[model samples]
Target: MAGLKPGAPAPQAITVHGQSRVLEIAFSDGAVFRIPFELMRVYSPSAEVKGHGPGQEVLQTGKREVGLLGLDPVGNYAVQPRFSDGHDSGIFSWDYLYHLGSQQARLWADYERRLAEAGVDRDAPMAAAGGGACGHHH
Candidate 1:
């Protein structure tokens, strides 16, 4: 990973709680967080969701029940999650995960705000497959 931040706390352990729909991660710095699958899906750092530039983020919806089918290691710095919805593009780094864990509350609030602003419900269905911010159309 070219942009891996220096001295970031690496994950010492990561547990996928399918029953609770949470990812329990313990870092080398002794911080533990239970990150929700939905949050990860909504905030996926992939080009699909985040697009290629600022202001192009595609808001994700109907991901409250999304599940992690797999969490695969990417070399030594990041993890790629295979979501139940078949979204496997986001490569979450250690620092990014930490940021998500720490800022979850704020992020949720922001998501809610965006939903309200768009007049869309939190559980609204997402757009059809192949029609996303990934710069590809089918």
Candidate 2:
């Protein structure tokens, strides 16, 4: 299905389902989606995730346990979700959120496949684990 149409009703309520690590949004149209934190992180619209252009997307692994750190509204059109992984650049618009909800299954499958193709060991050290920290005092 297509993304949210122009003039479409925005979410009437939004809740961070921390226990389930999902963000639940009930749109004015009565459509609700439970988006997993992992999905939101990997699919972030930030430059860190999307990169400068095509083929520059950084593969996000080891984020199955990530959580939503916080959220801030952007005008009347979007919200920026700060992730536990220190990612807070993606400004998710209403249309983009709708797109994500509609494409969640396929996008998640692709993310999983890419992780496998990259041979990223899921048990690898997390970024917060001091992975490759130089520890330079400059």
Candidate 3:
């Protein structure tokens, strides 16, 4: 998928399927994806999850119980996720979301490696990490 240009219209609809743990995003440009919540959480664009730069990323664990509580639009380019556990800071831009969707496999593998190094289970209870339980931004 090509990168989304700045100022382009954002997605037309974003739906969270609680039972499937998937987020369905439909863009005005006709791209659509049913992204799993685990994929979204593990690939959150927040600095806490993405880190300040490459190699600083913190792996997310215990996010199996997490869910998207709501989606709040941020201006014209991004959406703020109201996570079920009350996390609402990450402003997921259209470009970022698309990138994550395109690079899901690589990102998931990296996240799994980090979790292994941290001795954490991706589906277990949250540990006492600096960030919130699931490691997303506060």
Candidate 4:
């Protein structure tokens, strides 16, 4: 995966805290993060969320209470989460997870800004999918 960096710290432990809606991950380098499911859903690396290129991103909303239905490993490189809302295409590489964990605050701020610009409530229900590029990969 292009997102995986050389010598990146590998996860030592990964726990899904269903009650709190967070994915707690501990890295080999001793960095631990409790990433929220909502954030992961909103910032999913899948084409469904990121779209095909720049300026094509689909803003995600109403994910504040999103829950993880499952967490499946992707070989030795990443984890694919099955969200309660039926999103499961995102395969988050270790480096990407680390980035999310490390940059949570900045990402949240960005998401908030996007919502504000769209004049949408943070809890506004997402529009039905299939409005743009498909998430299918060849």
Candidate 5:
């Protein structure tokens, strides 16, 4: 009866830093995180990014300069981030945001490793031979 009660974590300030290509979020718990747009894009919660299930994840490559186009409220429980890369399906919840912030360094490293293993570059434009499909440029 002396600890914090169960409740939704509140985000004090959420900002899209275009200059730095990062999304800054400050929590009520006094934690502040500057998450790179590229990171969010690669780790997007959208089915397109995460896929319908494991082992089907589409590896997102060449998003080093991604930008945050906008953030919209999704029932006060989460925010939808629209990226300059045209990805806006991920609804980042408060808990997920916190996790991203806390685990950023490690997650990013893993992503880099995966990219290297896949022979991909973070800044190279991604192109695949998919007929009539939108390709990633830059």
Candidate 6:
């Protein structure tokens, strides 16, 4: 079986604009993006963000002002993002990050639609969904 190769290093530039909740990343590939923190928060690759199975996803709400508290490397393939709200579970792989950078608009729009359907506001205070505030079913 063929194994996956190690991912590339993180972008050289990462700027987070707290006021706008946007996290901008400029990759070596010359791709750049300004992804909203709310968008990142909702679409976090963590199990806490992405449920174990299809249709099991828990909607993330009240995260309009979320920010990245820290970024820690997970070996050579991914980076773990620690959110200011104390969420740190997802290991964002290079591929995942690239996808987010490319599909941000669509993902964000879907997230918003889901939130609306659930009667949740992205800017309100968050309440625990699965277990603890950071617990997710993966």
TM-score of each: 0.92, 0.82, 0.77, 0.92, 0.85, 0.79
Number of clashes recorded per candidate: 0, 0, 0, 0, 0, 0
- lDDT on C-alpha atoms for all candidate structures: 0.91, 0.80, 0.75, 0.91, 0.81, 0.75
RMSD of each: 2.1, 5.4, 4.9, 2.5, 6.2, 3.8
Q: Pick the candidate with the highest TM-score.
A: 1
Cα lDDT for residue 100, candidate 2: 80
Positional deviation of 17 in candidate 5, in angstroms?
A: 0.9
TM-score computed on alpha carbons, candidate 5: 0.85
Query: How good is model 1 by TM-score?
Result: 0.92
Off by over 4 Å in 5: 1-5, 128-138
User: Whose TM-score is higher: candidate 4's or candidate 5's?
Assistant: 4
Residue range 1-138, candidate 5, lDDT tens digits: 122236745789998889999889999889999998888888998877775567667778878888888999887668899998788989888888888999999999989888898888777776662522333443
- Model 1: residues with Cα > 4 Å off, grouped in runs: 132-138
What TM-score does structure 4 among the candidates reach? Answer: 0.92
Model 2 lDDT tens row, 1-138: 355568786888889988899998888878888888888888899867776678877777778888898989988888999998787889998877777877889988898788789888654555553323333343
* TM-score ranking of the models: 1, 4, 5, 2, 6, 3
Residue pairs with colliding backbones in model 3 are none
lDDT of 1: 0.91
How far residue 72's Cα lies from its native spot in candidate 4, in Å, is 0.9
lDDT of 6: 0.75
Off by over 4 Å in 3: 1-9, 129-138
lDDT tens digits, residue span 1-138, model 1: 385667889999999999889999999989999999999999999988887688878889999999999999998899999999999999999999999999999999999998998899989898796763465553
Give lDDT for model 3: 0.75
